[model samples]
Target: MKCSRCDRDAVIFIRYNGEHLCAEHFMEFLESRVKHELRKQVDLKPGDRIVVGTSGGKDSTTTVYLLKKIFSMRRDIEIIAVTIDEGIEGYRDRAIGVLSGYLKKIGVEHRIYRIKERFGKTIDEIAMMDKTLIPCTYCGVFRRSLLNSAARELDADYVATGLNLDDTAQSIIMNFARGDLDRLARLGPHSVVKEDLIPRIQPLRMIPEKEVLLYAILRGIEFYHGTCPYADLALRNQFRKAIDEWEARSPGTRHSIVSVYDELKPLLIERYRNFKLNRCEICGDPTPGRICKACELRLRLDKIQNL
Candidate 1:
């Protein structure tokens, strides 16, 4: 079938929205969404060093590709890629090779921080040591803490990630359902504005996961195709599948979900404004409670190992 946007033969059908996107139009559509989100969330200033948390996966690789394109139009901002190696044997090692090659080919400055070397424990090691902790959970906790530390080490003014629309929407629903207004308030395209927080920026906040994959494929960007071996066992996977099903049945359901968050953003912000954030007693990072989540998990692991 011909795409309605380009009147060309469509490569794939976005069933949720019944929109046909030709190869070129598909890229354009995804790029436009990225650009809109970036321009909206990031107040880029001259000489801003933006570090992207690139994984060797489709989402992150596509993020690097688009960020490069977007920043090229404005020469004032400097961009670099910072990859966190979670020390997941073949998974991270192989992906880093592709990521490094892509960054080298694109002439983007990049660096990888090996978590095993830094933390003395790989995510898999930690997960295996503690049956209660899931692999992705451990990986996520370590990655966030390490990403912030790496961003600071790289002298980055802002840290950008490849979190897409579905991830953000699912997080929103989870936060709201749990009455986590503070987290919900901080759920915009821009990560955190607090002085102690390493500003997290999501450029592809409005793009879908499928669109990201399609863009990577269409652009011939080299990205790891397989899921993280530990991802299937994750509780987040259930939320992901549920959202995928909803989006499948109701085209644009994910977009609508995000839109509701956007519409209610002011209220969320106001409500969470008085949530009383204090510096984490352990890590000196921003936290709604006494200790930051990352440090708390790390301490728990430490106690477990010591015991």
Candidate 2:
């Protein structure tokens, strides 16, 4: 197909906006949206440090690369990459290698945190337990806790993630389905849950997953293309497929869902703003209750091991 904007052959056809773009225009569109999100959500200053949660996937690779490109001349702003090793044998090991190589190529500082070292067990070990929990239940709670703690330790102004439009839409649907209004309130481009927790920024929340992958390929950005073995067992996989089908049927369905959530998020936040927060007595992390989800899971795992 012919490019909608220029004479070059079109590489992608965005159904929602009805724009058929070539590689150059597509890259421009993706980057411009991300830049807009960053400016709108994150108030970055001259010397602000951003800790990027990179998993060597297409989304994360694109996030770090784009942030660097946008702030290339701003020497005062520092970007560091942090990868969590959940100890998922073949998957995480290969991803770490890709992450290391990419960061080194771009000359960005990076760090890796292993679950076993910090939590006394790897994801594989936790999965083997005779518990009634899904792998993602444990993995999600622990990984998020580790990232938040790492961000605080690094003294970063913001912890940036690679969550795209699909991810955000799925999360909104999931939270609403489960009647998790608190979680739903926290589902915007930036988080403001607690003072101790470094706020998170999602610059790619406006972009789709397919566009992120295409952007990485067109830019020659290298990433681990493998899927996690345990991903099929998560509820998110189901949501992802359903959302993809909806997007296929109605080109802008995903964007509409996220847009609605974005519009309601501020009101939800204000309504829940005065909700009390406390520190987890065990880990000292902020939690709605006396104990955090990570601590609760850790205690459960420890009990199972003892049994």
Judged by TM-score, which candidate is best? 2
Give a tens-digit lDDT track for model 1, residues 1-307. 9987877899878765678889988788778878888877878889899889999888888888888988887788888888999988878888888889888998889888877776678887887888876877778777887888888887888888988888888898778777877778786565447665668888888888878887888899888876677877876767788888887787888888988889898877776666667888987876778997888887887898999
Residues 1-307 of candidate 2: C-alpha lDDT, one tens digit per residue:
9899999999999989999999999999988898898888877788899999999999998899999999999999999999989999999999989889989999899999887888889999998994589879989999999998889889899899999988988999989988999888766556574658778899899899889999999999989999998888898877888989998998999999988888898898889888877889998889988999999999999899999
* Displacement of the residue 266 alpha carbon in candidate 2, Å: 1.2
Span of 10 residues, lowest total lDDT, candidate 1? 188-197
lDDT of each: 0.82, 0.89
Give every collision pair in model 1.
16-251
* Number of the top lDDT candidate: 2
TM-score of each: 0.93, 0.98
